[model samples]
Target chain A: MKHSKISNLAFTGLLAAMALVVFVLEAQLPPLTPIPGIKLGLANIFTLFALYFIGPMWALTLLIVRVTLGSVFSGQMSVFLYSMAGGLLSYLIMRLLYIRMKEDRIFVVSVFGAMAHNIGQILTGVLLMQTPALFYYLPVLLISGIITGLFTGLAAQFSIKALKKSPISDSP
Target chain B: MTGRNEHSLSALQWILIFAGLILLLLTVRFFFDLSDGNRERALILLDGKTVRTLDLSEDQTFVLDTGYGTNTIQVTDGCVSVTDADCPDRVCTAHGPLTDNSMPIICLPHHLVIRFEPGHGDVDIIAE
Candidate 1:
């Protein structure tokens, strides 16, 4: 039992580091669209994997750590609030959907999760700017979220399938 | 295992539903943008307060100092735009121009927002 616990901690720590690296690297790229709150969200691939393979708690921790560290490393501390809002909302929605659906349906969960993340960020924008005009961007964001979510979700799904088939066993 | 297969079917169904919903949303948004008439007035707000209101018909250029940063706004021929900004993101500047009220040009770092208001009556959307 102790050995399993240690392995779990080590695994989660590794995943968190990998997620942070991806987040930082993605941030370095030019904005895909002039519109804010739209991105590839590649780091979420790891979060989805951790959510299904490790557990919800570890996944949430990994998300929080990655967002916090990513913002700090990127030198855009001002965006940390928006990142936190989006990351936490995505994690919660993913967890809720995962509980209701089968493990094989993680891609769907990721789609909804990405939508929730966009909603959360839009809400933050509204709260910060105190304007409903931001809602105009909702449709554009929703479409982007779906497309990007599908990409990351499929990536995660395939990675998990391959990992399961690998010789090294995943930590429970 | 049976539960897994059944859930997979439902997941596929959900994905289809979401895809349709997204398509519908995009359609609605596109129509809404097309139907929106040209706006004549632009309201500039800094930190939730009305800093200036400009007539889009008039051609003018001005520099706004928000204390945190500066933005160069230009109004010409029924359009308004941020030509330059000191904010690191430059998103507002990159946004180019505003011919309608669909999306406000926002510089979050500077707490600056430039939105097109249809007329003077509903300009105070954000209550101080």
Candidate 2:
């Protein structure tokens, strides 16, 4: 049991590193549209995977570190607050739903998480800009969130299934 | 948790939720449609700074001083577009026009934002 625990921790660390790399790589991609808030949200696939395999606590740690480091490396430190708020809220919501909902219905949690992140970010934008006009963008962001979350959640599902049969699956 | 059924909602419920969302979107689009020569207002932001407030009712074109150079954006036919920019991406140009209230014309390097605001006569969605 002690050996198994060590291996699990190591595996979690590796997954965290993988998530960080994906987050960094995704930062280089341009937004799909010139809109300030539109993007592919490619890194979310890793977060969903981590949430499924390593569990919520591990996933939450990965999110915090990734956002903090990513913002620093990108020289967008000012955005750290928004990213933290969105990341934490998304992670918490995902965790609750994952714990409470049926396995087949897990994707719904992911969808809600994505929407929550967009809402959280938009709220931050409104506060920063000191304008209520930003609320108009809420609908668009929520729609984008639903689509992106579905794609990322599907990716996570497939990845988890594949990983279960791989050599790494024996770690725990 | 065994045989507690595990599942909360049936497949039918999921379908209903998606259908409802679609219906809401269509209704919003139908009511909020904006076209040529409509009077509106837009707020311009450069790197989080509110540089200017534009009135679409009167101003057809204006030059924004980006501290680097002057960039020109024009509002015509109930749409806003970047006619000229010193920025390298020229993304603002590609954004074309703003018809949707949710979509904004953004130039990241310049931190410029151009988003549509419905006229005062139009109903505010938030108020409802």
lDDT for model 1: 0.80
lDDT for each residue of candidate 1 in B22-83, tens digit (9 for 90 to 100) = 88988967754653433887789886677898888899999999888899999988889999
Clashes of 1: 0
Candidate with the greatest DockQ versus the true structure: 1
Model 1 off-target regions past 4 Å? A1-3, A170-172, B4-12, B34-38, B119-128
Best-performing candidate as measured by TM-score: 1
**Collision count for each candidate, in order:** 0, 1
Error of 1 at B41 (Å): 1.6
Candidate 1 chain B worst ten-residue window by lDDT = B119-128
Extract clashing residue pairs from model 2.
B36-B77
CA lDDT of every candidate? 0.80, 0.67
